[model samples]
Target: MFELLGIPPQVLFGQLLLGLINGAFYATLSLGLALIFGLLNIINFTHGAQYMMGAFVAYLLLNLLGIGYWPSLFLAPILVGLVGIVLEKTMLSRLYKLDHLYGLLLTFGLALLIEGAFRQMYGVSGLPYPIPDVLKGGQNLGFMFLPNYRAWVVVASLLICFATWFLIERTKLGSYLRAATENPALVQAFGINVPRMITLTYGFGVALAGFAGVLAAPIYSVNPLMGSNLIVVVFAVVVIGGMGSILGAILTGFGLGLVEGLTKVFYPEASNTVIFIIMAIVLVLKPAGLFGRAR
Candidate 1:
């Protein structure tokens, strides 16, 4: 087996695969944040809690209702997304005219409250979610074995990310969303329901988070704190990609995942911090982020 940089091929490739998997999750999660901030102009702090809710929903569907993975994958997101829509209509809608800090504080409080409720109910232990029967195995690829589920994650995340980008950048409804964000009064005058669109956009963005959580349930132990643990890193990814850059989030996510993966191989001590180091460098050099436009 050929070695790269004197490291065993299996070890290097294995870590890279793991990194890609991590990146998939990062990309999926950050994409949601970008959409919410970009279109709705509200920083959703409850996003992580929403994500945790998705996983718990899936678990409940499986254990309580005897629903399996496939149905839960679609259903969990919708249920959680509807909750987001309600929150938007009742709470987040009120904060749009306020400073960004207000939106941030409100959502942040919501996140803490939601997480605390889940903790009180479930405690801190992780609940196991079984991988679906169809996606249970792995394939040997000479240098490394690839798990079917993880590969599905990467492919699925990429598809969802790209689809979202296309919808926002290339489609008519997406055009209305972008336009409404820029000038809601003008868009509303054009006979478009700006408030409704904003509400739907927030719901859709949150749905993306829920979708990621479903993908994550089997891989990570589903716990109340799961989303909290990953969210800080995902936020770091959003900052590095730019506050509202959708494409930036996707590319930077996968790129950082690879970088973090390789870091683990070359220098395990710095693996956890490499993304932040890169974030610091990016902040210093290009404050708008790699793909974000200067405001």
Candidate 2:
């Protein structure tokens, strides 16, 4: 077999594919964070917990209700999103005029509370979610084998990310949303319900997180702390991408995921820390991030 960098092509390509898969999840989750922070100005520490909730909800639907994965993908996000809307109306909205730290602290507390509640019930053991029957196989691309479900994840995540970007950047409704974010008072003066728009935007962002959770369920073990494990890395991706920059978040998430994957192949020990190291470098050189604009 031909080799690159003295590594087998299979190993090299396999790791690259694995990197892309991880990138899909990172992109999806970070995109949600960017949306919430950019439009709502909320740090949203509870996002990880919301992600955990999506997986749990899907698990419950499948085992308890026999709903299966296909339906759970859509249903889980909607259900979790409704909960997010309630959180915005009942609690998050009040902090809009306050310091960003306040929103961060509140969401952080909520994350702990939610995680604690799930851990109490589910314990720390992870649960398996079987891949759907239709997506159970793999394809050999000569150099590497690609699992069907993993391919689906990459395609689905990229499509959703693009759709979200287009919605926010190239549509009429998106213009309204951007307008409200920039100057809510003026938007409201023109007869738009700014508060409601903000609430829905938050819900949509939470839904994106929930959607990512469903995609992750079959790939990773489902557990209360599942989100806890990945959220930090995702936050790093958001920071490196420039928080609140949609395009930046999408591109950066995938880019870092590939970087992490390759690091694992070349230097196993550094793979875990590579993303953070890049983050630190980005911070020192450009505090605003690679894609973020300084205010």
Candidate 3:
């Protein structure tokens, strides 16, 4: 068998698998950001904070309330989503009529506030989340061993990305939401509650971030700054995939992850900046992004 980029097949495949796992996260996170920007027209800087909150929320529920991963998986997102809803209603909603920069700044401050509060409480230490028993094994895949939990993460992320795409592209409620995104006044004139829809949309977008956080809790350490650096990469993925299309966001996320993984095998030094380099290339070649339609 030809070694991939002169690396051993085993090492190559392992990194690729890990890359796909990280890509799963990128897909989910970027998808949430894309949904928020695509519909709300707001660059949500608080997204990373919200993702961190979801992981922290699960940790707290597990330690303080005796809740486990299974329950927290659903509860954490809903709880964080409520927090998002409150933000939209009280602050984000007020910025809809203003320039997009205002919303971005507001969310940037909000991210700082959230991360600071959590860092103060948790002290920047990583908390471990126990994996559920049902998802705790591994399968031998000849070349690489596949952990059940990581596999679940990829599958779950894909299911979510697909389901969201379906809902947005094929559903009646999605039609209304898209219409509201395009023109709230016209949507409201048609008897739809556009403001409420916006609130729910923001909530839902952050909820997806929360869901990714929950899935990530078991694999990565749950920490206040967990999403800090990760968010930058996710933003790059969004730019490459294009905020104009959720499917584009999802595809770019996973694709870049694989690319990153491959790069790690051949040129370890470039692992960190590969995605951004790709983003720069995309910006130069296609400002609208891979899947984004030209404005």
Best by lDDT: 2
- Candidate 1, residue 244: lDDT: 58
lDDT of 3 by residue, 11-37 (tens): 988889889989998998888887788
| Per-residue error (Å), model 1, residue 223 | 0.6
TM-score winner:
2
Listed per candidate, the RMSD to the true structure in angstroms reads 1.1, 1.0, 1.2
**What is the C-alpha lDDT profile of model 2 across 1-295, one tens digit per residue?**
7878899988887888889988998998899888888778877888889999999999999999999999999999999999999999999999989888899999999999999999999999999899999999999988888999999999989999999999999999999998887888899999999889889999999999999999989998899998887889998988888875788899998999899989989999998899999999999999989999886
lDDT of each: 0.90, 0.91, 0.90
Off by over 4 Å in 2: none
Task: Assess candidate 2 and give its TM-score to the true structure.
Answer: 0.98
In model 1, where do residues sit more than 4 Å from their true spots? Answer: none
Q: Candidate 2 at 127: error in angstroms?
A: 0.7
